[model samples]
Target chain A: MGRKRTRPDNIRLTEVAELAGVSPITASRFFRNPEALSIGKRVRVESAAKELGYVPNLAARALASQRTEVIGVLIPSFTNNVFSDLLRGIYDAFESSRYSIQLANTRYSILEEEKLLRLFLAQKPAGLIVTGIDQTPESRIIMQSVDCPIVQIMEIGPDPVDMIIGFSHADAAQAAITHLLAQGYRRIGFLGARMDPRVQRRLAGYQAAMKAASLFDSRLMVTTPLPTSVTLGGTLFADLLAKAPDTDAVFCANDDLALGVLFECQRRHIAIPKQMAIVGFNDLEFMASAVPTLTSVRTNRYEMGRNAATMVIETIEGRRPEQPIVDLGFTVIERQSSVREP
Target chain B: MGRKRTRPDNIRLTEVAELAGVSPITASRFFRNPEALSIGKRVRVESAAKELGYVPNLAARALASQRTEVIGVLIPSFTNNVFSDLLRGIYDAFESSRYSIQLANTRYSILEEEKLLRLFLAQKPAGLIVTGIDQTPESRIIMQSVDCPIVQIMEIGPDPVDMIIGFSHADAAQAAITHLLAQGYRRIGFLGARMDPRVQRRLAGYQAAMKAASLFDSRLMVTTPLPTSVTLGGTLFADLLAKAPDTDAVFCANDDLALGVLFECQRRHIAIPKQMAIVGFNDLEFMASAVPTLTSVRTNRYEMGRNAATMVIETIEGRRPEQPIVDLGFTVIERQSSVREP
Candidate 1:
């Protein structure tokens, strides 16, 4: 084996400044605010810095200025479109600000969230933007330790860690249930994904709306552990028909699950909004183009991301944002899936 | 109006070191390599660091040691599952290495890639992982200036800047086409997503294979814009059928597009394999579970990610990597979609 290699000597700012024909302070200013310098100076400094392979001393800056210009983003999953859309919005908001984002995925596990929190805390980003507030003890400790601003997104928490920016899952679910109820869907069934706290909250909200309307019966609620796939939705529908043959409506967890459920209904010769009504959450772009146009609760995922990013950036700059608790709100999109003929 | 308030002075590492009864150098080493130091001293230093709200200065450490322990990843889109799976593999490899990832989506735009490249360079990450090799002139300039290792993923280029870890898209496409021909699929038509350079290479390979086999008829190839959803795939199939009514087989750019074509066949009461055999690229998980399981080209997406991450990490540590060009290989998976009875 080769002998252990020695550490490379650090490339200093002073050397870079000398190469760029500028003072050390000017070199520091280039790293802090490259745009503040003239175009010619910016080009010269960047060229010299690149030639020297210079990396700014972020730790020293953090100690002296208390700013890292890095944002921490905690997301549920990268596999889904909703979260991806939200991330795109956050990215757009910070594009011009030169603020880099650090992402951590919870993978739908509360335990994983705690681990990610500790990891994120070690980095000491300028601010934090998390999805919801169903955090573990260790996660809470990490969040409490963060002196920077925090913004909770996707769903409102009972008590926010700092700022809150999201639509109410309960309200969105209630809207879907009420739509089914209005269409004379008495024996309605609820289909959902497995183990997400937010989805569970939606299920609870759906049940509450049904109970408040005095329509909570044994035949109406059917829960199953199905993977979020269209085929699973099809299989679940078949099982639902076997259990409760008279079920006239179904409320799905989200659009992907709903699409699967719809495909099954179509295969079984079930006329939607005629024999059975279907309602979904998250009015994804495909919902409108879907056959029979799916009726869904439209949560503004992109706006939620934009608002959360904006709040975090503002708080990082030592500005108190006007609204710490931002409820972007949701809308019930009426489509062919739930509209019945008079 | 309230008087302008002054910000609190940031706490320094010197203060934490003083409180812990250790030198600032020892404290810095503790933050960089905690496990290497004595446990008794580690506990005392960690406690003091925590008590003093000491955020280990990352910028300072970067300046001093020339290692940021961060990796920059650039992808075209996260909405695609193939890219996401690749990312999962990369994350798995780096999880234990304690390297954080900063991701940016170029949205398949060269201009966006150039801009994002500049932003990534400013962070001074240990290594860079880019999705494809087709970069802009400005991006090329910035990439060359970085002294650290860079790995290009997903597609192979004629010449690599530093490292290339991916499969040959052209070869994979040719294999798919030859497999179709071997299965006696003549009058085969190609249905592809938008003209991404990589996808175009696959199309070109298909065209070459067709011509070599003396089957290069005008009616055998079809091309459309990409970012194609399953719905679009379905519509495109219908349009293709209207034009080439005698077409016996269709090769799609990806599984999503193939699924759409398959769905359209089901809708039109057209028989699969017997009427129109279908082949897809990227053997996604859903393809295996799909109703008449899809025939597809399986690229080692996860392995691609793992290899790229490992190479970057090892290169950063000054280890001479064994291979700079890694082709994990691809396979043609034959399922019900393209199978025909004798």
Candidate 2:
């Protein structure tokens, strides 16, 4: 093969085939389905293509088929560790697949998500994996009308647009509160940040569980609209103590807040479980490795992502899932931070 | 607007224009550049398109232009907090732009990165932003030959594939050790995981710093190829202790490891800075909220990403950056974790 600097647009598959001393159809097959070609012919076509700088006209191919091998994914935030695990699962499941991922960040705004939905639909994506069931009315209408496989992830709810998979956020939050109550701790305070829809559902569950036990106190709740971070976690916990100093336990919206609460307890000489107890959502890796291993609600985020992608791909391939809605469920991991001394 | 179930492939641009009572060129302009159309025409075309369930033929447009309004991003891992900050910058920079992001995870494999490079080049992206400067030779050749502007982020080095922006990992690591040395700590060890090229540079800096002071010891190092995590940080610190129990200070490759080492020290009753000083890289938010705030190297990850993206976009728009090579640099944030009581 010669080192030729052919213009990307000018190098055709036929020229590559001629240079490789193969039929044009064989070279074309090498580009579309290399597995169908023998190894010798595959190598020859690839070398010739590389030498000639033959870039496949993906646009022309997509135009002919009226579809592109692309899966559009919409998520709220890129910095949040929760979504990171989910994204990893999605990427892992599609590693060997033909579909390329087109990711859009909604920035936790319903309007932004709606705009992105319109854009993706315009591209005629092979499939889609949306973050949650909390899209705006316009987004919902567009998604319902579109003809593509869709997977709603991060929370399970009624009236899914297509396939859906995720545990109930409210259910998980109530379970965490129940575990704390079982440990003989009342006067439980809730610390939250980034009050997104899913988090609001968690707060609702906390309220429901507390009300059931006749331990609900309006002053026990402290939340913020600001984005969540360890710093914010500590700030919210401090605010909670200022409002309800007699609080015996705290349930954080997520693990970052839980770790912050733990650090605050350590800073103030507060004893774990004795003077104060803490429970967190999303059993992030650091929770188990903290000084006092933290108790947390472990959601199957990775599994949710992997399964959602698999479902979308399978649906696109004409294999409809037996159950359109799947609840991966959650686990309450008991640890040193919340276990009381009998 | 009618809720007609018009087939996506059947609705043409001309029909949308006819319904809106506008010329076909005006309808086309509404899709390609809404800002170029007046508010009256834009709204009319949009509503008509929605009513008719019209989808823009982006593939045909891409073919005509020989480019896509897509900026391909290649990163190593999704779960790493370091890259999360970087990705947020990239996404934020392009929030209002015409280009959409096509993201691919390389899983830290050079060969995988090369494969992704070929795939992305085939799409004729408007621009590209790649993580790190450690692309395989084949990938480098492909990148160099590509027509679009490119930015190599994460770390800086000689030679420009197009443009580059990042800091020196070795210099940052050396500065971290110098600070530890100034604190009167002689036996400084290193803890690292996910020994990617950048981490290897940090290890090299640690070695250089120790050797300069005649305190280098092969026993004072623990590195792992396994992915980095808070749990792995504790495991590696435990192993380091077993190998060099007399070690007085440690420089972690990232904040996760530093946080883990802090927890392990607390578990073992080792007074931080009093018994073992700690330094971490990236200075994640948790580092500040830890009981004893941890010291860390503050790299401009967000700035790196935002600026890299801005540079690529500007280059594509025919406005070359004032400087082709950018070094954002790093700062050694002194905190309680590594500061010895005077």
Candidate 3:
């Protein structure tokens, strides 16, 4: 039956409720907060909504509830694989939920993040998931005053806007460097690109690890402000090799650099993990398939994303997580690119 | 000045009008239709709005004008690198404009796309950018009835919802296979993973090229409906090799498959281009960084995204493109992996 669809979403909640074999209030309650309803009521309501082609007027609902049926998600880059992976987890988590996602790409600019936050806050989203702890003080103030629950992802920070869920980039970096040292790479160098705040934290971890081994040398660390690419990885690694040929190993700030180092070494006929050990960050799917499978920091990016979404949604639904700040931790996957002992 | 930001957004259109040195009516008109106003008035109103950190209530605005200040984008997969590149282009194009984008990932499900389109339609978005033309017939009916302009990207078809901006995946695949044939590889095979509609089109192209060359062996074409990954490439290529031992080259459905094939070749100590050639789709940024430098179909994904966004915006602003069906076209970028001649 083709129902009379009006100017602005004419799907009646009563029709959906009748089809779902539930009360109209129950159907509406499902949209507002599915957690409040029983499982049978929730499934039946959802199925009916789908069959009847019912789409809740999020805009009208927002007006009445003073809560936009939207989630504000901020990330650094769209092209970056890391954020893409994190977003996959986020979308997966949010798909079954009623709230729509509103994404903003800050491009690693704190000012841009602040500006986007202003725009997002105006939407009065039900929940928010920000990327890191590096938002501007002005933006932080605005965020603090907001009524919605928020979760900062991808970095473990002592101070959070509301709650945070991520592994410690610094500690993860240290583990990567320590892995290299344990595998007999003493003269290890560090290569970084798009040296954002997170990269800086990773560098600090590398420094801490090297210093612990009494091999602290600033000369071996090469960095660039340019946006990162696989080719840039090669450029930075070549720069490191030229600057410090004695460097027996290198810990890359991220996978691109590590991959670049791998390619550059291959082009020049330099053996890996035997003569020059290399470690990358964020074990991208490609890293595993690369020749001499790359060793890298394996952060639970998907889990981090899922947890962040869960934290905000739960907080909004009156289910507070026991711990506001969750340090998911990281693991260093030992592969041929780093672990040579085997 | 910490203004009392509250329900209904404390920043009023009057404040924006005063800041821009214009009447409130003019400012409101600017938000409604910038094209109706002179350039000077439009700039002044926008700048004033930005300076005062004002965000127009898009929901309220949509009710009055029946045109939501947003674009509804339906994508297949967010995690896939190809879609990410396209989204990067889309985001860049929409960033400067007043319209915000609301994206929903359909996960390559036609039903999901239909559901999302229904939801998106209910929102009354100003325009819509759908990924492919493979919408369900029911969904197609709804789409045809929508008053807003629509632009479908990624795959160009004869019957677009309204407008289309993309290259033919089939034609692109044929070009790739033709390139390999020109390179004198007669025993070339095709490896496809996650055979979504686009990939299916690509496969048809492969079949077309191989049949014309009289080399179409059904045994040589290996495919999996499982989601694609770099390692999946290795697995599928190995399976292909097992079935067709004379396979001298392989045309992958996408870059991930190509990368996997390359890694498999390396693991097995097979020489690239010399012993076996390879071609990949979607010349992703990392393709060039691979050891032998993969040759792939270079599609203008970013341009497609940008063009789609531009078309939607221009339509909303009352400007129509000369053509509704745009074939942006594709190129076969010759690289080391496929170019044994040059």
Tell me, by lDDT, which candidate is best. 2
lDDT of 1 by residue, A302-340 (tens): 898888998988887778798778888899999988988
Tens digit per residue, CA lDDT, model 2, B88-157: 9998898777777888999999999999988888888999999888898999999999889999999999
Model 2, runs deviating above 4 Å = A1-56, B1-56
Span of ten consecutive residues with least summed lDDT in model 3 chain B: B1-10
Which ten-residue region of model 1 chain A has the weakest summed lDDT? A218-227
The Cα error of candidate 2 at residue B176, in Å, is 0.8
**In DockQ, how does model 1 score against the reference complex?**
0.31
Docking class of 1: acceptable
- Off-target runs (Cα >4 Å) in candidate 3 are A1-54, B1-9, B14-27, B33-54
Candidate 2 chain A lowest-lDDT run of ten: A1-10
RMSD from true fold, candidate 2: 4.9
TM-score (2 decimals) of chain A in model 2: 0.89
Q: What are the per-model DockQ values?
A: 0.31, 0.69, 0.61
